[model samples]
Target: MAFREGGAIGTALGFYLIVVSILSIGIGPDLAILSKIAPGVLWGTLLLSALLSVDRIFHNDYEDGTLEVIALGPLPLELVAVAKATAHWISTAIPLVLMAPVLGMFLNLPAHGFWVLVVSMLAGTPAVSFLGAVGAGLTLGLGRGGQLLSLLILPLYIPVLIFGISTMDAVLVGPGSFSTSFAILAALSLATVVLTPFAAAAALRMNLQ
Candidate 1:
């Protein structure tokens, strides 16, 4: 599927960047530039990859009747949305986290930077999933929902993206600090927790009726 392909491209690109960095041992400034900017690059690529993968969250279910049953189930729709998004986070986001070590190493990240990437991504990807749900819900019935999805989710992801990058960036080049960025990442995740479900549920209801 296109959604899976998008995620694959993202994962592939991240690793490709790493390989390029290593191969550039004496060829150019590739490793140096990657080291200086790798955290942001890593998080940004992961976010994009995860975002692209979310397009399938409800597309098939809605086209069939599964979403209808889910909607009418005893449990709240928001909870269902949360569950689906959590699954998505596990599949897409977890891979990115696992790959961070390789990426950090390629970027010449500080010895401790890998830890920072893992912790921050663990907290951040859920938010990406949560927010992507809203986008998915909004574009649920559109033929070109994927395009709209990117437009909607990108702005919402900025906060998480910023904090995630900042946390790892600090590990690589700053004062060895993380409290502030980590708090911001947690806050962004919390904000999505509060805001996305209402929109996702409302969109689903509209599409159903």
Candidate 2:
């Protein structure tokens, strides 16, 4: 409700799309340079875009006391955490994934790398939402803790960024190369998705206590 009412979902999507579009233009029509950097630029933009929306994961609910009621309800707080993170991924990350191919084309990304980009993003971005939930939970009462949330969350995202780009970079070498990176990225996302809900639930419990 808060995300819809506040337009945060649209803002994050629009912001990253425009930023990537501007980057594609600002870098000029040099396909060689754009293609060379496309993986890094696109992945970085996705990370930043996810960061902008993560704060809202728990902020409004926490403020309005809904989170406390949810905590006391039959649904476990950990499951609530998972649900919020999943909703964030659907609302925020999926749009980014859809736009990535078109943005990749705009940056003159190689056809081979295009599918790799989409696959890597699909595999890796769920971690952003899951981990961001922990960050948002930790910073719940900080009063506009978006900046602090980014600081707390961005470091944890480093592995995702590294492997996400490596997935594309390794594509130039051989199938085995990108596959290995994508596997690690998938592992990371899976681990975060499985574990961070508990962590976030703990954090929310601390805040509530």
Whole-model lDDT values for every prediction: 0.76, 0.88
State the local distance difference test value for candidate 2: 0.88
The list of candidate 1 runs beyond 4 A from truth reads 1-29
Q: How many backbone clashes does candidate 2 have?
A: 0
Error of 1 at 209 (Å): 1.5
Clash list (residue pairs), candidate 1: none
The worst-scoring run of ten residues by lDDT in candidate 1 lies at 1-10
Candidate 1 residue-wise lDDT, 1-209, digit = tens: 12222334365446545554554454455656767766776787677767767777788788877889877779788877777777677666787678767766766766777788899999888898888888888899899898888988899889888888887767667885688888888888888877788888888888888
What digit string (tens of lDDT, one per residue) describes model 2 on residues 8-86? 7788888888999999889899999998888889999989988998988888888888887887889998988988899
Top candidate on lDDT is 2
Worst 10 residues of 2 by lDDT: 1-10
lDDT of 1: 0.76
TM per prediction: 0.84, 0.93
- Model 2, residue 204: what's the lDDT? 93
